[model samples]
Target: MHSRLVAVAATAAIALMAPTGALAQDATPMASPVGESLFAELGLPELTITVTDEGIEIDRSDIEAGRYLVTLNNESAEPEVFAGFVQIPEDRTLEDLSYADEVAAGTPIPEEGPAEEDFLWLYETYIAGGPSTVTEAARQVVVNLPAGSYGVWDEDPTSPRLAAALTVTGDPGVRVEGPEPEAAVTIIEEGEGGVGFSFRLDGEFVAGPQVVKVLNASDQPHFVEVSQYPEEITVEQVMATFMFDPSSGATPSPDMLDYERAIFAGWAGTQSPGATQWVIVDVAPGQVLVDCFIPDPLAEFTPHAFEGMLQLFEVAES
Candidate 1:
């Protein structure tokens, strides 16, 4: 009878050990080689995230069944406080994931625990303060999810630019579209001396006409304007007007110089960094001066003209 009892005890012990071993394997976190890095090539800063007292939530539904890292950066000179929690859709599947304030060598960020009202207060205060004081801050949230579309910013309508859509398609052949140009150029600054920009139109007094696109690769806002000079003029005359007083209002009378006119004048208005704008104009045969006029506010602190931000494109036969 004692031998029989020993056998039963041994069987129970083996069963307990089996479950413990399985649990240990399930608890281990898995890493992915094909996952996207938060800060790989695109130059940007780090960010922090938290839950606010107001219960503001961000929708995050599009992520593959793996791990992810969200990064936020402080673009302005002032310190900003962000309080909110990331919302995960019910239909999606996720795994062991965590959130952190600092990534690599960046500044350390703190996670504010679950609170909705407090988060709303913080957001309102920052928006009312404007870009001059509050500036723009970024946040990065990391998680593991199954494939779908995830919305990053939904709490504040005033902050649509912050909204990011994350799509997780399982196909390995899919590619992320790089930034492209919609217009020839954009004026980074406006007003007098700020930063005005212009583009060349390819139209002859009577010839082929086509619209070209210019793309803005910088982080500031920009626009484009078009102006035309006399069809029959020497290089010296063109140099005099561009190098000398452009706004002298000096006329090249019938005898002194040929008549020049501003045929098309359109601007791309203001474009945020990494954005594109399209400026269309009929091409004209002659020497065209594409000036990027900088508004006084932006030009007051920078020398964009001397630095060659202002370009002059020549359109001849063909």
Candidate 2:
């Protein structure tokens, strides 16, 4: 993969796969007094995880299946962190999951992997909760966890090597509903050569802090990265920058786009088909870009964004 493409995907993965916290008024949101007040309104049990150069520390690891306000306080030397929890089946252990290496390396795993590599999707499908963005600033997400054994881990191998265990005890059959979302975003598959997988916004996005429900209706697992692009930048430009060609080894230039100008608002973590989660979105009145970078094995591993999974939503003043 081109360094440019890898960089962009890596950035999104870091933000979308970590233990997020509350949002502030700026593009790079931080946990603030106002944000904490907003979280209190969710009325969900708060699960706080503190990360440092040593490792990860969770205030509590045992709980029943239910929705929670997951917050990550990054106090490490690293600029960003990717930390999350995935169910480790009774028959499996952390050693049984080979995809951890790729994750720790910040590589984007392709969907529909070969027979031996099928665990990639399996792992994705089993992600119980905890999706985040790259930030030293505190951020958070609302997630519903099922009863199961889980492993909390950091995506970067060099960063603290945290893989603590978690236990969510409850009946597997019962489904607990999460808080109602102020806005809804659905991820859908477009079938073969039909613009691939894309996002379907159920309604207009209103500015300021709000809970955005993200549902994955596609066959394969998917995640979303939310950002605000300058109005002058057209959708065509974004498409071109995200375009990838495996055969020619072609990739977008690192200089093709100015990342500093792209303001990251939030991340709705990876979800398997029919899964739903809610993320905290706090943006000023502007255009917010929703996209996915997961590679499609059925399409030479091209990113879903290049296949038309990227869309701009108008955020009206609240």
Candidate 3:
């Protein structure tokens, strides 16, 4: 199974939020990026999920199973959180798979426990679309939630762990047809001498605000981290910053990745093979790097980019 916790530590810092069954009692209003962005054009139902120091807050607890414009807010003073909804196995209770206490205390989950493994399975297979990140502001993305009992938890191991429970009740319906995206991005497996991975764009990426459909076609789970860098920054320099001696067993510092300076566009969180998510990103024309930092367990938890899962492409004006 892919390790969400270690994905960014090996390359960069990325947090994937999962729910832990703690439900907020009342609804609260949070800023919705959707109101002023291209996401509003989709016209899907809206659900607000906010992560503060106290706990996970959802504007509502129950809803019909379908597509939603999920507004994720990381209001916590510290900690970058990835907010996504996940449905655990029917037999598993929220307590059994919750990461709240341990993550808050910064303690490792018991080695013999199934919580970590179970959470990973749920994330890659049972998750609906949620934003891969919400650092300190509100961002909106589209998620396809299905009928089930969901535990909403911030997936960042270092963040204050709080969970809210959500219940989706309805028939397992067909995928909610949405608007056609301006561009298509795919995570594909590239096996040459050995197994490999990479990202592919359907055509030239035009600058400015647009909708993108990210599809994971590979057998393994994957995510996309898109950033814009100065034209002077070479691919080798970015690669060097992420390079490390895995045998040393040291975590790479986030500073190394940030020192070079890149405008963070956005990311699509980890998704199971064949899963598809749509997100809105506004990017400027410049040298862009599309990379996957998700670690490959088979490669001793080495980040995917080390295996050539990165693409340096140009974003041109229309």
Distance (Å) between predicted and true CA of 210, model 1? 2.1
lDDT tens string, model 1, 1-318? 111111121101111111111121111112112123322333322223223322223334343433333333333222332221222344421110111212223533223222222222221111100000011111322222234443333222222123334456564334323322232322333222334323333322222232233344443323333345445554345334334332556654333332223233212222223333232333456654443322222333232232234444555555
lDDT of 3 by residue, 59-148 (tens): 999998777777787676643455667676777665533456666667675543322233344434465545634221126667677777
TM-scores vs. true structure, each candidate: 0.30, 0.74, 0.74
RMSD of 3: 7.2
The lDDT for every candidate, in the order shown, is 0.29, 0.57, 0.57
The TM-score-based order of candidates, best leading, equals: 3, 2, 1
Cα lDDT of model 2 by residue, 248-290, tens digit: 7666555444554566676665565666676667667978777
Model 1 spans > 4 angstroms off: 1-208, 232-260, 265-267, 296-307
RMSD of each: 27.0, 6.2, 7.2
Per-model clash counts, in order, read 51, 11, 10
